[model samples]
Target: MIEIKNLKKVYAGATVVNVPQLEIKKGESIGLVGNNGAGKTTLFRMILDLIRPESGEVLSNGYNVAGAEAWKNYTASYLDEGFLIDYLTPEEYFYFIGGLHQQNRAQVDETLLGLTDFFNGEILKKGKYIRDLSKGNQCKVGVGSCLLQKPELLMLDEPFANIDPSTQFRLKNILKTENKNNGVTTIVSSHDLNHVTDVCDRILLMEKGVIIKDIATSSSTLSELEEYFGVGQIVTPEIKVDKEENH
Candidate 1:
């Protein structure tokens, strides 16, 4: 279970995030969406303990995130590329994260069997560095590394950004399986409305550093979401100008 109360953040004299109260129940998959500077990443950072909030507290499983070490044990996050070890090979990175979670090499190997496709023959290569890999491949490694621990609370930010279409589909399947089968509490932040709509049980929309809408996927349709986002209809050819004719 995750509990948030009065969360707020200010940078350089401007408030970037403010949440009076929010509670995410165990085994729930929540999607967060917001415009570029709307504080989605900031809130995730605070929840992951990467940044301290100006006020308020975040609790995971009855332990305050900033104050309790035990609370962090059950949480795993992939907020950015920094979580990855640039010098380690993909296999080595997996082993390192597994070891940190007290799992042995055999256990790690077993866990990674399902993700071998993501490795694309890079798993056993000993000398290759993570930093040298493509951005999409690096993201795959980061995601696989985070899942090595089988965390109770998983937080991901823009997970599909750099991935290809096929890989993106695979990732969506993996996340859905993890949430449905293991009941892992998952929070995903992405700008792709369709991606979020497909898997999220609930969606929270943020604007100007505050949550402006919160609705369940079952209760809302994609069109409804587009409307809620306040964007007008998709412009068709009839509405678009003919550049050559205008010139």
Candidate 2:
């Protein structure tokens, strides 16, 4: 269970995140959606104790995230490439992270077996360092490492941003399967509305550092999101003119 109360963050005298109160029940899969600068990442950072909130607190299973060590045991998150070791190869990186979670080599190998199709054989081998892999591949490595931990609370930011379409589908299935089997609590933030809606059982819409909507996923959720997003927005197509024609 996750409990947030009066959480706030300020930067240069501007408030970026402010949540009076929120509770995420155990075994819930939640998707947070918002445009850039909506404070989605800020909220995740607070939850993971990566950033010090200006006020209030975040509690994971009754343990304050910033004040206790208990939450680290069952919570895992991948917000960006910074979580990965660019110097290590994917295989080496996995083993290193797995070791941190007290997973032996054989157990790590077993955990990785479930990710073969997600990797598409491109992540492992190829004799490349993590920094050398493409951004999409690096993201795969980060998410795979997080999953290897078998966390009770998993968090991801923009998980679909750098992945290919086919791999995105596979990753969704992976999360769904994990939820079905383990009831792991997941909170993932994404700009890709369709993908998040497809994976999450609940959707929270963030706007200007506030959660404006919290709705359960349903058959009509996509259309509802589309309708909500379409309000007061202008999408102008670029006009292209041939150089010769312009001359």
Candidate 3:
């Protein structure tokens, strides 16, 4: 459903993202994990057409994302709190997004009802603007808005970073259900290895603007990633590592 070809981005004479080629199929769940400056967010921005690539292109459903508006109809993304309207209350923000998708207030409320448990009783009717909420609560708002869209392709960046453990677990279940049951093409970039591994069927390890490893999630996927990041005691040989040069 998505394809990247020779995509590259540079700033201040340094290359930040340099993907040669990548493809994501419909209903696939992909996890992107990397340390600081790994270009995860940069790659996401290019895919979303928030930023133009210096070279190459990103395609969504056979159309170049840089020049197409059709993809936006089915794609939903939340990269950070910046995606939120800080001045608007959560309800108002959600309703506005719903309107953008031609959903009425009743429809938005019905969709939100499904997220009651995911919200953990902290998101709705809070009476405060989105900016006033805690970082974790703000994250909940961002993700909740994405779900309200019922998108075919969902992209979230560092979705588990600031949320409490309970919320993180709920979010993982939501993502898994979206992928498995709803057949959403989901791409999540996260630093939390366990959550990403549990939610995604494939994992991409990036570093220095390069995709150093792309491994199908397996029983040993988490261990392999931890080993690569030097957080595990043993490396699992079962995990395949696609080096940057091979790309």
Candidate 4:
């Protein structure tokens, strides 16, 4: 449902993102993996049209993202806490978003009820502005908001980073259901290898602002990724020779 071509972004004389071409089909779950400065977030921003690419374009349903508003109707994304309305309470923010989507308060409540398990009893009636919540709780709020939208295309960045293990598990299940049962096209960028691999059908390994490997998920995908990231490699110390003594 999404296509990227000749996409490139640069910062301060350095190339940060340089994707030549990529495509994401409907109902597919894609995982983007990379270290810091790999340009994963940059790529995401370009897709969302939050940042204009220096060259090339992103297309959603064959319409250029840079030139269309139709894609926003079906896309939901939460990249960081910056996406939250920090001054508003979680409930208020959710209701506002719901209103924008033409969902009444009752509708919003019903949708939120379905996410009770995902919220883990920490979100609703918190009696605090979103800014006051902990980082993990804020992440929960962000993700929860995305679900309330019932988007056709969902994109999240580092979603597993701040949440607890149980919440992470719940989120993974939610993603799986959204992709498999609901046919949502999902693209998630994460540093958590295990979680990403478990939820995504395909993995894109990126480095130095380029996609280096794109692998279909399989029994061996995790180990292959770990090996690429040097998870289990052995390192031997270098030995020094006494050249003068030998002479």
The most accurate candidate by lDDT is 3
Which parts of model 2 are misplaced by more than 4 Å?
Answer: 233-247
TM-score, prediction 4:
0.93
Could you tell me which 10 consecutive residues in candidate 1 have the lowest summed lDDT? 238-247
All candidates: TM-score: 0.90, 0.93, 0.93, 0.93
Each candidate's clash count: 0, 0, 0, 0
Which residue segments of model 3 deviate by more than 4 Å?
231-247
Please report how far candidate 3 places residue 56 from its true position, in Å.
0.3
Q: Which residue runs of candidate 1 sit more than 4 Å off their true CA positions?
A: 120-127, 230-247
RMSD (Cα, Å) for all candidates, in order, is: 9.1, 10.0, 4.1, 9.5
Pairwise TM-score winner, candidates 2 and 3 = 3
Which candidate, 1 or 4, has the higher lDDT?
A: 4
Which pairs clash (backbone N, Cα, C closer than 3 Å) in model 3? none
Candidate with better TM-score, 1 vs 2: 2
For residues 1-247, could you state the per-residue lDDT of candidate 3 as single tens digits? 9999999999999989888889889998999998888899999999999999899999999999989899999999999999999999999999999999999999999999999998888989878999999989999999999999999999999999999999888899999999999999999999999999999988988887888788888888898888778963232323345732211
Report lDDT per candidate.
0.82, 0.88, 0.90, 0.89
lDDT of 4 by residue, 101-177 (tens): 99999999998998999888888897999999989999988988898889999999999999999999999999999
Residue 48, model 3, lDDT:
98
lDDT of 1: 0.82
What's the candidate order when arranged by decreasing lDDT?
3, 4, 2, 1
